[model samples]
Target: MTAAERIARDFTLLLPPGWARIPLDGRVPLRVKNLVTERVADVPVEQRETLRAALTRELTAVLESAARQGGLDVLLSVAPVAGQPVPASGLVTHLAGQGNGDALDSLVGTLAAGSGTSSVREIGVVEVAAGPAVRRLTTRRERVDGQGDLPGGVLTVTQVDYFVPLPGTRDLLVLTFTTPIEQLAPPLVQLFDVMGGSLRWVTR
Candidate 1:
């Protein structure tokens, strides 16, 4: 199989058997719009569009940055449950070259040093189907800024980043999962690990 085909299959097989997939580029905008509408319900209807435009711009920028790092992205959504533990989901990014662990470590460290509200909790190498991967966990506590309604509300976020270098090709795969601290249970974290370990890059 060609590298592209191999990578496509790798992403498809990454998801657990029955999960549903969502196109981030297509759904993100609509989701963001809904969020803005719900959060700013008290605002004058006429001005809602203006507010949405601003919020969407900011959100799109952030997502775009991440998308660049992962040339291709895989996003998923699980079936609904009466009370789901946030329906665990993640983003996967693949690039046609290996990633540098030392550089990533330094970059993460630098980010932590500059941000008073964020910290790097752990950094190390772990084995995944692709090969040895750099794993880093980080924690950040920030206020929900633009949610005009939830003014000053603090939110703690936990994020795990995995940098996997394909066994044979100079390619790399980046996987990331972020969840609110309140919803990041041990079980969910374990599920993330298991899903990540199953990433196989077939080059045949």
Candidate 2:
């Protein structure tokens, strides 16, 4: 399999019960479980889709904390905006900046520091748009780290990944952020059991 596909497989293991991945055009489906009802639901997109969740605010703060301690890649969930039919533009700044790895790194840092590392798996059914869709984000923070080969423009970077059931319903939202972020899938699988058997999202 291609590296990206492998990454996708690795990441899918992170989902919790009731959660699932629904394949929509231009979307990488990611499914999650319902917290209370034990119902399963499908998240429309993957990649930065978790950012599309409702917990963006809370997650930003949590990841911010975790990054301070070590590297982080979070898998969290948030409720979706019902009937809202996710706007072509996400509520959160999905495409906030478009530049080099430093710029991306900075954005990640800021998100991590502000939100702190979060383990909130409450949200579900979020719409996400990565690469160029987020046109109106203001750089909350910026730090140039010229240490690595690709010195990142660190922003206390933190990624808030959230999942929510469809129709603004309350369900299990899973959030986990730490480095080796590539390991997001397995944790998510565990998350499924934690919440209860839910949806098994379809993979591409």
Number of the top-ranking candidate, with lDDT as the measure: 1
- lDDT of candidates 1 onward, in order: 0.60, 0.30
lDDT of 2 by residue, 1-204 (tens): 333222222223334322232321122122222221122134434523453454344444544443353322333343344433211111111111222332434434444454434433332222322111001111123466686587656443222243222111221222322222223434533443333232233334
Predicted model with the maximum TM-score: 1
What's the TM-score of each model vs. the native?
Answer: 0.58, 0.20
RMSD of each: 7.8, 19.1
Q: Clashing pairs in model 1? A: 1-204
Shift in Å, residue 95, candidate 1:
4.8
The regions of model 2 sitting more than 4 angstroms off are: 1-11, 17-56, 80-204
Candidate 1 lDDT trough over 10 residues, lowest sum: 76-85
